[model samples]
Target: MTEITPRIPPLPRAEWTDDAREVFAYWGEPNAWEEGSKTNILMTMGNHPDLGKVYNIWGKHLLMSNTLSTRHLEILILRVAWLVKSAYEWHNHVGYGLNAGLTLEEIGAIRDFPAGDDWNEQDEAVLRSVDELKNDGVISDATWAILGQYFDMRQKMDLVFSIGHYVMTSWAISSFGVGIEGGADQIGFDLRTASGKIPGKTYKPGEVEDWTDTRGY
Candidate 1:
């Protein structure tokens, strides 16, 4: 897809200050890799400099190690990305989703999963929970029952925050025009114009129409 590239600062990793270098070292990265994580590292470490010192490492650790598997994390992330119509996020994370065993059908169906007969029980629950959370800032009891059956209390807690955190990230990408820097493939989600046949129209922030009480964490 043709996209208007957003103007952002080039990464400044080589000219790091002593403090930034210390932060980088604390994260256990003395070197950089060319593929996969370069853009994220550069964005989180070098570009987003004003953020919290260990924001990069700590945020990734929360998703990678704590809340859930990379598979489930990618699920919520891709869904949120699609909701926001973030071509950058959808392109970047689809490969990660595939590597984590999410099928092309699964990835494609996330945009309006409520109408699609494409997801399993667990996948549906996860997607629906994220769907409600993003649109309404809460998960309904029906969806929670589905998630609670599979995830323990800790996993469930982290799962909640993980979805919210990713919504924060996707919102930043869409609103702040944080352009994706690497090889970006287009998933071409048309969020603005509803086809009138799928799950629903685009999800806009601050327009969540409903709310439901969720469990702790």
Candidate 2:
């Protein structure tokens, strides 16, 4: 994994104010501010408690109440993490993905969809939609038709919103340089070591036109 010095280091527990504590409380038992807590993303959000609180509300919905199946949700999340190359997001979701029932080979196959025989028709459509959204900012008609065959209107909406949410999340995680939590379970494939088959341009910080070979499929 690429080492990133946090541009906005996680706010220490001692510095957490009442608002921050309340925001952290949303995660339930063993409050995030308590000792031994390893939710670095929430800790980083502590820098802006108001944002944390609201963001948590939206995130909570996606994680806890979304109409999409756990398998599909994790698939979307892992794909976005791979597309954006957010190691922190990727690492955390790898555990979530596994727990949600995706096998290691299936998780690894997310790096390049349709290249392996791990996915079914619906699963393949979901993967393709993620790539389409990433590259074109829209899901193509063909992909939408495939999705319509299996997902309801609500599920489709959740699917798109979930992708957009994770994309935004990956941006924040990368920009904030949130590192993997301490003692995090060693599960899931690391983006640094995963092989990617897709082609896309790589942009350096602050250099719009000066890009190198395609990276982060």
Candidate 3:
């Protein structure tokens, strides 16, 4: 990958005032404010605090509250991130994807999925759904049927919104030239890394390779 230089460099920390501080605090500890948090995106969005607040709220819902399996969600997110060339989002989520039970091969295979033998039927369906949404803005009936076999209505809806959400995120980060968070390249997120300090543990795939909310929702 070529080097990416942010056209809109993050606002200097020195410039952070009350409102900036509020947005910073809004995202909260490890995931948002801790030392190596992916704050570059947050800070860039922080340039406009009101927008940042709402964005973070929706983001929290997507990352934390949605009913989709973390494995499936990560698959959709990473695929969109790769196709859109949003290295910032891709780099960060790679760890989240791994923690959510995607093996390195599975993550790498996302680049050339359905054609290869790497993906199982459900995985193929998820990736195919992303492809359809990315290219055609609609999931073909065939792909939807495959997904329906594994996912319920809420999960299907979550898949659509998750892809759409990441699509917008990629566009914004690429257009704004947002770089990775400070010091991320030196020690970025990895398999051992959990997705920061969520109140509970990150979701792990269960016996059926389906997700069960450990927290009981």
Candidate 4:
């Protein structure tokens, strides 16, 4: 594993101004700074406050809206993260996925979904949609019909936007070399850094396995 480094490191907590603090507070203090350490994603975006503010609005809607269940959304998110090979996105969402009822085996199998029997029909549909979106830039009609069978119009819409959000997020995090949260390990680095190495924290496969299996939800 390569050493963890951030090409554009996050703003330090000590440097946050009143307006910056207020903006972070809108999302929740812990989201931007936790136990005195700034969250890399938010801090990186914070460098451009106006852009970060607008992104926060859309982020809040996606996270808070009840159009989709946590489990379903996590399922959709994990698949997109894995397909895009976004170490940052995948590592962070591993905890969210577990809390939302995804098991370790299910989460691990996301990288090669249909090969395993852990996924149900709905799960398969969601994963299939992610594969289609990532490879083709659009979900195939067959996959769309499968999704339509189980999801409402809003759930379907949420699904598309949720994938879109994470796809862009992965690109940003990878491009910026956003560091992982302290005490966390990076996964899927080989794929994430495919374009070029920007220097981010990377952990050994063994270390990442231990980290991934024990996030404490």
On the 0 to 100 scale, the lDDT of residue 4 in model 3 is 67
Steric overlap count per candidate: 0, 0, 0, 2
TM-score of every candidate relative to the true structure: 0.70, 0.82, 0.78, 0.78
Error of 2 at 22 (Å): 1.6
Find the candidate with the highest lDDT and give its number: 2
Ranking by lDDT: 2, 3, 4, 1
Q: Comparing candidate 1 with candidate 2, which one achieves the higher lDDT?
A: 2
Tell me the lDDT of candidate 3.
0.70
lDDT of 1 by residue, 1-217 (tens): 5555545543565756654454444433324332112344344444544563556665656655765777787888888888767776676566567666777667767776777656788888888888899789899999899888988998888888877777776766665556554442234464221223222222111123320011000
List residue ranges in candidate 1 displaced over 4 A.
Answer: 3-8, 11-15, 21-30, 33-41, 44-52, 182-217
Local accuracy of candidate 2 as per-residue lDDT tens digits, 1-217: 4456888987776787888876766666243446423466777888899999999899888877889998899999999988888777777676567667777677788866667556888999999999999999999999999999999999999999999999999999888988765543323344333234221122321223322111121
Which of the numbered candidates is closest to the native, going by highest TM-score?
Answer: 2
Shift in Å, residue 27, candidate 4? 2.6
Worst 10 residues of 1 by lDDT: 208-217
Residue 7 lDDT, candidate 3, scale 0-100 = 79
lDDT of 3 at 76: 89
